[model samples]
Target: MKLAATAGGGLFLGFSWTGSLASALEVVSDTAIAAGEINFNSYLALSPDGIVTILSPNPELGQNIKTSFPMIVAEELDADWTKVKVVQAPLDTNKFERQVTGGSGAVPHSWERLRKAGATARHMLLEAAAKRWKVSAGTLRTENGFVLNPANGKKLSYGELATEASKVPVPENVKLKDPKDFKLIGTAVRNVDNHEMITGKPLYGLDFYKDGMLFAMIQRPTAFGLKLKSVDATAAKAMPGIVDVVTFKNNVAVVGKSTWQVSKARKALKVQYEAEAALESSADHDRIFKELLNSTDATVRRKDGDVEAAFKSAAKVIKSEYQCPFLSHSPMEPMNFFAHVRPDGVELVGPTQTPERARDQVAELLKIAPEKVTVQLTRLGGGFGRRLSADFALEAAELSSIIKAPVKVIWSREDDMTGGTYRPAVRYRFEAALDAKGNMIGYKLRGVGMNSGNPTREDNFPSGAVDNLLIDSVEHKSPITTGPWRAPITNFLAFAEQSFIDEVAHAAGKDPVQFRLELLDKAKKSPVGEIKYDIDRMRGVINLAAEKSGWGKKKGVAQGFSVYFSHRSYVAQVGEVELKDNKPVIKKIYAAADCGMVVNLSGANQQVRGGIVDGLGHAMYSNLTFKNGAPEQENFNSYRLIRMKEIPEVDVHFVHNGIDPTGLGEPALPPTGGAVANAIFKATGKRLRNQPFAEQEELKTV
Candidate 1:
């Protein structure tokens, strides 16, 4: 590997990658003179000193896109990994595609594009080196920031060739390296921002501050179905550090010099809110679920063979219902955004999962052109799919426009928890029929949810495995707002489906592992319909998980296993539980996944581990319920979260493959609930049909 080359010391480093800082965050650095950096493309910049600047186009939500995405560019560019500096790219739709980071779509969508960007830059450097050496371009190969000629001992650093490479014509397409040659791709690279984060450096949205920016806090409607009717902010306006108090469509905003002042002043405002419609409680949601289950008005997603005949002829039938509560995203950092809105344009700087949509939403609200809005993204403290919506961003933009000055809006933890857009509470019913010999004959699923669209994964798993299978979905609209959770419907659906599969296995008097394997064999050999999951990949993960955990071999340990395919990936998990004081306690979990080629081993491991913890925690202790259109739990005191004491060791493994990468951020999560539920049943002889397993009376301790 060649050393990292630089463009030259004290040369111009001032190239506007995005645009001028149009808002109050107009701090300046870099650029001593003419920009010496060579713009190979929108994503890669080469300095004469052999420094490679790689732009990460997607938002980073601790899923490690910032580190992993740039690894792809560095891998193909043959740049020294230690010298490659990754910077978060601003929202530039013209140069980057798919800036959003949900559905685990970032890597799959940008894999080819990023590889091409690096390959193209490498090609230009080869041409430049060849011209300098007076040799054929094919004779030059790049390695660690250098173009080396094997026939001759001559080599040129990327820094030395940067100036000449800038003049070379970029090819229409460049060859990407074969997967076997990947250097940085699968390597365990540390997060670039780890030092800054551990040192408490300013990086997240909450840390953002400008010279003349004012802080604002909003007082929204207390209830979901209510709206602000009147506001008396006379006292709030008189408070110290208070700047202005204004009302928007549904809430009142208190602007002040600091967060503490705004927080205190917002409490002083007397706001009157009135119900715009009937206020429904958690009980109403429960009744709605029951109504939808019995109602014939359902959309049939998949149908195969004769379900009625199979059920009628079956010697035994097993039926079970599973329920999951609505959940708050509850990121470590509360919702916030910085907005500098002027008559001509707007500047939005904050932590958001969807920057383009945020700019678009603000543009629509203000009746301005999309180009008039510029969004600068900050490192997020956490998202968990919460930042996908632009509600917080819109609040800041609206308040900034009203105040006619740069402003940052912050949401109190209570405001963040009770705010709308929750993971919808859902109910699922599963029924399976078995013949006299205990051979599975039929399978059926009914999903009912509030504000859920196509709550059923009709094409997955047993849909193709069973001889007779049916899947149906019923969506009951409510005043409550709902959007995509981490794994969307699969978060709860997989738990219900996998647990029911386990129950059927037990009813058939077959080993749970053997039962799932048999089903997968059926799906692979003579599938009833088109199977969306790769049977080979799914089998790979399941077998890997079983082997790693020594399935059915651990003594005195209750074990449960679950496998699921979602977000274009397959994951299998084995949960081990131990009995303490006659109560089931989770001890450890083994997870195996096949998400194709991993970008970074360290990041991938952490993502899988984090997902496992998140899924298990929610299933074990988290629940959100509403009373009279208001959330019963506004903060952590009433709400529950997975604590350090409950978090067990999570062992992660991945199938070794060079196949193109799929999604990894959310796939490992969906099956964890089912695995834990199965393990608990083995330990305590109790079936947990609802989320917050600890809250169930049957299991004394979960």
Candidate 2:
């Protein structure tokens, strides 16, 4: 059955195609949004009592988009920021277009749309007052909450005219305030949700609860292709507080009154699984990648000049192979979800990147109308692409629908690590040719594993678009499943490519930052024939980072510099480090980014810093291993993350081009891995290629 239609006449949609309840869910539409009282006036509502309610459509995952997005609208509406109280918007895609938040596009893409919302509402308020007092609309101006007509000395607060203004038509082509006139856009504002976070409120999925809610835990097989054969419900059902032992598809779920009870029951339940080919191990991934490198079956992403002839005729040749291990997301809060299912409808609550997707998936699974499904989004402890999958939410929906009651399913830390949608492990083979003058003339990159494969069809990134780029992927083609991770395959490819460039710089006796800038300069000025990048802007970030980090000057120790651009954002990083007791120590980090017009400087800065720290953690101490097709890394004790003390001081600077904004969250990440590796090379003369550098041998500083 058709669910709801959006204001723009699009169907609100939901689904769980991956057989997990989460993958199938999403909010497709909400026509009521555009027709509602608050909808006609921008997303913010100011009452006579001086109370302000800010509608936050996207999930707040500690990125500060919650505060920043509203700030853009509030600035245009001339609303008092301090008087604002923010609430998470429901899964209403009709009202909140493109509500799926990821890729750092939240603020940059939504800035204009949200500002118009505010401006339209403000215009309506002024018009209402102008008509009431018989004055020109232009003469009736609004400030804070009051609308004043100076000509007649008549004034009315927004609260007094709220009902009347609701009847006024929403203005089209409403004038937006100039950026220069903004009182808060470029300024640093504290996160509106920070206080609730620090005080530990019930804002996250883990904190969600409902009366008579049961907790469920699923027992998965030991290997990817293994299937559940049989289970003895007797033992699990006998456990105190355990409700029932039900089998859904292949796995058995134990439901109980508490998470611990359910988990213990699931573990104790006697279960057996059919075994399939267990040959797909970590070592197998390495073998398949190597085969791809050795094969001639490659899809060309980009090509310019006769690169082959350039290499053969040139003076020098340099080659390198780099590898990166699969890694886990490891959000502080393990993946969890709350679901309530009844004969009439279903309710699902969780921290998710795609709320609308969750709604659709669950409805399809239950064979119910889309309107019967409701998804309540919670603040994510951390996403990094793991939450992008609705696996946990889907599982809860499925189990709750079967159990005919409200249920919350929580994956233990072990389950979270071993069960995570891992960032694909990768291998890169790079070859370059240089002239006698130490100028690079030719380059080729052959990527293996998933990097050679296609990204999700939904993302729309052309598969293999880099000039001289070759992608040759050999999927294991087994029953094993995987999904995208933070930066996904691109992150893996970036480390290898950027680090190899650093190696080339050292071989040619050139400054690393200067060497990259030259390439970017070439791409920008000349016609590359539809190359997917802004070369000049890329160089701008590199130069900005170099200047800010004192690239050529030795302040106290060694530093490494690197630059990379992706998802429409450009970033350059400088990592300051020192070698002590055979380990690399990061002293400081300087980051320069160009994502266009600055919306929230503070939030942008914070996102860059966080991405850097995340990349640093992956470089220093993160890896996901496998045993007989099952992940071996089961928890934080094994999969290390950067702690508070290990976090280096991060300084972020944004390069303003006075244009539209781009993504800021991810672009800053890929370069951090390469920059840190380059710096470690300086401190220890080691070119550490593979990840989890903590286990690599340390080089002595000369």
Candidate 3:
């Protein structure tokens, strides 16, 4: 969906895809949305009692997209923000489009579409009031819940004209509110689920339970390459509260009346598995990376100019290697989903980032028509790209189908850590060639990883700035599964790329901030290749970050600078480090983002802060290794997370603009590792090339 915001907040439909817009809105007819009563299909619905309920389509995953999405509709509807009750909308593919949430795309995907919904409803209300007064809608205006006429000083609440508005023709196009005239937007509105959350109400999937529903616990293969061969569940079935024991595919599930019963019974089951592939370990991955990095054969992702010639004639050549261990997507709430597979249809309720995918998967597994499947979305405790995979939901459906009973599959923390998709372990090799004048002439990057796609962003920053650049990758298909983790490749790439750029700048005897500005200027003016980033916005955030952090002027403290553009957002961060006991102590971080517009200031701030903290903690102390195709860090006992006292004060700044908002869920996270690593380098002369910096001697506490 190609959408651009016009000067007057009008939605510009420049859909490049064939028949997508037509097919997406096929469910919404003019009269369907013109109903006088509340419609759950569309986002906005008004009642005769002046009650406004805005449906949030996407699952709430602590990113605050649910609250902010509804705010968009409410803002354009001119409804009282306090009066509107936001509700989680179920997956109605016929009625809603892109009900899934991932890639930090919830806002950018729903922005224009949601605005049109609210504006169209407002247009209907205006016509309803105009018809009642026997006047043209041109003279009618709306404020709060009332449609008004300035000439007569008379107005009618939207509730009063709800019935009459049902007959008004839905406008093909309605003028969207200009950003400058926004009333509820840019305000620090609290999260709609804040009260329910703080009061410990049941909103998350872990809290979801249905009457007569059984709880099932599956015992998956203990190792990645291992497959379940047999399960001796005779003893487990005899245990107390154990309803049944079923073997589906390779997993052995123990079903019971409650979580505790099933969990306790699962321990009694003796599951045996055999290896289907060679058992691989962390040491094996390191060997594979070393072999791939040195191998001449590699897939060239992007090539521009003559890289070999530029490097051969260069006056200086610098080379470095960075590596990161695999990471677990340990969401606070372990994966859980409720599924009821019946003879006629199937029902699925859970916290899933992609509800449609879950529904379709379950339907396919059950050999049922797609229409026979229904999905109900619940609040997610945390996704972090883990919930994007419908594995947990599918497990529930499969078990429920075989057992002929509704069951909720709950993953213990250990099960989740050992049997879930992981962030791929990766190694990046970077080489820079400089001319006699210290100008970068040639740049080369080759990434080696396990199950990572491409692992290179060739069109990102510094790509167009350089005259000669070559990007390539080599992948090792491991038996272990890996999927998107937060910002995906950029989460680790930004740290390596930005840190390398910092090194290049220092080697060229230039300030880090000024050096980045120069690159952005190069990309903006005369370039080499197609640059995907907005140079102006990148420059703006970089300058803003430097200005806000006192980048160069600060004394008795070391500061490092980094910036990255990801998920349609540009974020520049400045990190400060103070040496204590000869160890780099993170003091504070200043973040400046150009996500175009601010939807909710409070939520946006929390997002940036949370991303920074998460990124910092992982880069500094988190790592998941494999000794024999099994995760080494299976729980918090072995896994390291940043403590409250270790968290630095995060100061966030947004480049306020009238442009449509992009994404904040993942963009702010990518640059954080780079900033923190750069700051550590500034404090200590040694460079930390590996992730989970605690593994490096420099970061080890004395």
Candidate 4:
């Protein structure tokens, strides 16, 4: 390693190396730039005086990728984790492409790229040291940020070689450490942001602050397709602290110096809207669902094995209907955004799942090039697919641009609950034909729900139609807007399908797990053509769950298990329940999942735990109703979230197969509903086919 003196008492270091040969490395830095805000995703440089720097990338979503991703690079580069500094990645797609993170794809996708960056730097420095000693590069090895010649017992620090390494060409195709040889990965690492998260550090969008920034809140129309006929902002403009009262399409926004003032003023504003023909209430939506069930105009999704003929020849037919209501994402932190529109460009910062989408939307809204609009993603309190949209960012940008000053748009609990996108209410009508031998001869499934964007090609099945399979969906045109709640629109449909299978099994006096195993066997042998799920993997998860849960063992309580394979992940869960004081008390849950190539076991378990808790909360207590074309639930006081007091003892076990990883977030959600629903049936002996079974008037356990 070599260091050269620079003009301002700074230092220059250099390293040079050749691919498959010896090399030298060089780097230079100034020590005057004192410690600044930490950005963990960028390069770290140091001077002869030993000052350090780093670059941080991606938003710090509650799921801790902030420390985790950087750890990957630090581990491979052999950098001192403690001494390393951090800074956020600026919105420069050219320099840092793919700043967005979601779909559980971050760890798996970035693992290699980050490792190579570190390994290449380390290799170059090692070559620099080897060349200085007149030794073969192959004989020198880098370890813990140090280049060492084992034979000569000499070592050079990465800092000492930093300058030299910069002068060396970065080696292409540097060797990566094998999993068995890894020191940091696969080990239990706590979240790097735990201190910040717990201590209430300003790390989220809601905490954003700007000079001369006004607070804004909007009053959206009550119903869908309701045209705003008029609005008088006179009273609001007179209110103390109110800065400006303006109207945007579909709503009026009240801007003030404080959030409370804006909220209060918005409520005081006089407004009128003209209701459209579709402004029918909750009862109307229910009626529409019923009509969909009877409608003959449905796109067939799948068919298999002369299903109609088999139904005709069967001795018994069974039918049932299940319904699910709309739901809000209800993240702990409500939607928020901070926007500053400068004449030259716009700077937008917020908690968003899709930063790329936000950048595009802001660019379009401001009529500026996408490059001119800077989108800064912050840590979301939670994002169960809700943050995927940039509506909040767009709204804030619009308000800020209108004001010609920096503004932070915040949604109160009420605004967030009623104004944002929702999961559409859906109904499922299921029917089955059974033979004398208790074999299913035919199955018919019909789903009705508000249109959720456009159903994919897989949604309308003719692609993999089974011989007698019949799948259809009737869409009820909706005025109430909706977005992807979790895993497409199939969340409710899969719940109905899995639960219906449980009902059929109970009628046949067969174990629920065994029933599913049989179906998987049938699907594998002569699969209802091109079934969406992996039969082998599905059966494997089911069998494993059954074995691990002691399926047939009696514990003086009823237990039911269900398996669902979706999003390329397989999940099986057995929920244990006991009737207490006429209420179902969930005792415990055993979950077995195989999301191939588990990257972070801790994060994987977190997803499952969160999913189970979410499912239980919705099944037992959550429901969103509508009255006169408006949502009935407003905030936590009305809509329920599973609390610590209600959570069951959850045991999550994963199959440690070294296969490619799959999604871990939403796959755990669908199966949990059916699993708990089945357990309720076992405890009560009353077939519970609908969601929110706890709310059923005639609900009973046996």
Best candidate per lDDT, number?
Answer: 1
TM-score of predicted structure 1: 0.96
Q: Rate the local accuracy (lDDT) of all candidates.
A: 0.89, 0.74, 0.85, 0.72
Instruction: State how far residue 60 of model 2 sits from its true place (Å).
Output: 1.7
Better of 1 and 2 by lDDT: 1
Worst ten in a row by lDDT for model 1? 1-10
Model 4 residue 198 distance off true place after TM-score fit, in angstroms: 1.3
lDDT of 2 by residue, 1-702 (tens): 121111222122334322223324354343633212233443665443444566788887877878877887777767767766677876865567777777777877687898897888788878888778877898777777678777777778765675566568876689988777777778888888777889988889999888888888888776776888888889779989999888988778899999878877777888888876563677777777778778866656556557778778778888888887878778888889988887767778889988888888887888887777777788888888888888888899998888888899888888787774777666777787888977777777666654325522211111122133223333334344556666666576666777888888888899988777666665555544455566678778888999998897985578988777777888889989986666678899999999887777788888888889888888888878787878877877777888899999898899978777787768878888888888988887888788877767553333
Clashes of 2: 27
Q: Which consecutive 10 residues in model 2 have the weakest lDDT in total?
A: 457-466
Point out the worst 10-residue segment of candidate 3 by lDDT. Answer: 1-10
Count of clashing residue pairs in every prediction: 10, 27, 0, 52
lDDT of candidate 4 over 585-681, digit per residue (tens):
7898889998775555576778788878877787677788877677889988988777899899998888766655665767787788788888877
Of candidates 3 and 1, the better by TM-score: 1
- What's the residue-level lDDT of 124 in candidate 1? 93
**TM-score, every prediction:** 0.96, 0.90, 0.94, 0.89
Ranking of models by TM-score = 1, 3, 2, 4
Of the candidates numbered 2 and 3, which has the greater TM-score value? 3
